[model samples]
Target: MGHAADSVTACLSKGLGASVGTIIAGSKSFIAKAKIPRKTLGSGMRQVGVLCAPALVALEENKAKILAEGLNKIKGLKVDTASVQTNIVYSDILKGSNITETHLCKILEAHGVLTMPKGPFKLRLVIHHQISESDVKYTVLHSESCNWVHW
Candidate 1:
């Protein structure tokens, strides 16, 4: 049921919980061409199975939904919950609000929550295997109580 593409690259280090490595797949001719860069960079796939093992475990988890849903309830932020299918969550601060992504990130950081400012009004959050349910709850609770957003 997956859509077909000419070439695909999957980064195993981030969402997959792998320490390192990216898997690129394509036609034989495409791979043959890609090998030039791989060999030039001294990249090897030998013993990569050990790094790939954690992806199996990470695939079974969907902790981002728990965090996204909780964040959606905050008064000034809007989270498109349906679009969250992986470990990444993107939230937008509504226009006319007196808050920038950087400001929001600082408030979150002061409360021990770390988030990345994607744009003036957009913040990005990543949920990995290390993020627990309690961590999600604490983030949402603190975010709501921050009271930094003002239109």
Candidate 2:
């Protein structure tokens, strides 16, 4: 897991650097050619002390628990592990014709199990520390009872 994470991070860093370099080069060329003044560009920085402080603290405190909960959700769903890399998980419903993805979302929402519709027939579940194993079980059971065909 550590090795895979490291590889993903490395790839992301390389990709990010390449993208930033391209953006910077393009912006510089555009600025120089257009003679756009700095003030006109609105590229000013302000001190966001409060926002930065909490964000830093949240990253330090909540990252590990969030990752663990995500793994648990993936395991509970028993679907593609790759889709659980981040906090979001996507699942397809193959239930009855009238019970569309939107209908399923409405059902879950009415039961306080909020989810997002992905496509015409896809639903997205996001795992958070607040959601427990029992919650996952209840969600799955409810979905199954509704005769949702899993994809």
Candidate 3:
């Protein structure tokens, strides 16, 4: 099927959980030409198997739901667990909370957890293969601290 396309690409990060890498395929001539820019952009490297190993584990684990369920238990945060189908989870800050999503992210980061603010009141969390059950618990523990009545 690739013969019909000039080039094909797939990311090995995100859901695949590879630290970082992408697959690019094309005609031999096209690939040869592509190598120059790949190296120029510093994407060409040796021993990349180390970076690609986690994807295999990701295929066997679905940690996002675990994370989403945990987040749903936290106060001031609303998560539709049914919508969590992959490695991404989104939580919204309920109206009663004074804490914005950005503030909540900073609080989590200060406690050794990291998250991204989706909008003024939404938070985005990505559960990669590297995150263990204990890590999820830690995230939830800290997130629960944000359950302050001030929110």
Best by lDDT: 1
Which is the better candidate, 1 or 2, if ranked by lDDT?
1
Which segments of model 2 are wrong by more than 4 Å? 1-79, 95-98, 148-151
**Cα error of candidate 3 at position 148, Å:** 3.0
* Residue ranges of candidate 3 with Cα displaced over 4 Å: 1-10, 18-56
Question: Candidate 2 at residue 101, lDDT?
Answer: 67
lDDT of 1 by residue, 50-148 (tens): 766766567556588888999898888899999997789999998876888998898999998999999879999998778888999999999988887
lDDT (tens digit, per residue) of candidate 2 on 1-151? 4443312211211211221111112344554653356447864333446434543443343333333333234312324544455445676554344456687798778777788888766677765534555776676666655543432
Best by TM-score: 1
- RMSD (CA, angstroms), candidate 2: 9.9
RMSD values, in order shown: 3.1, 9.9, 5.0
Q: Using Cα atoms with residue i matched to residue i, what is each candidate's TM-score against the true structure?
A: 0.77, 0.45, 0.65
Question: How displaced is residue 59 in candidate 3, in Å?
Answer: 4.3
Sorting all predicted structures by lDDT, with the top scorer first, yields 1, 3, 2
Error of 1 at 74 (Å): 1.1
**What is candidate 3's lDDT per residue for 1-151, written digit by digit as tens?**
5767799986768655676767776788988999999899877844646755665567458677888898888777789999986688999888878877777888888898889999889999988777888899889888886665374
Query: For model 3, what is the alpha-carbon lDDT of residue 87?
Result: 80
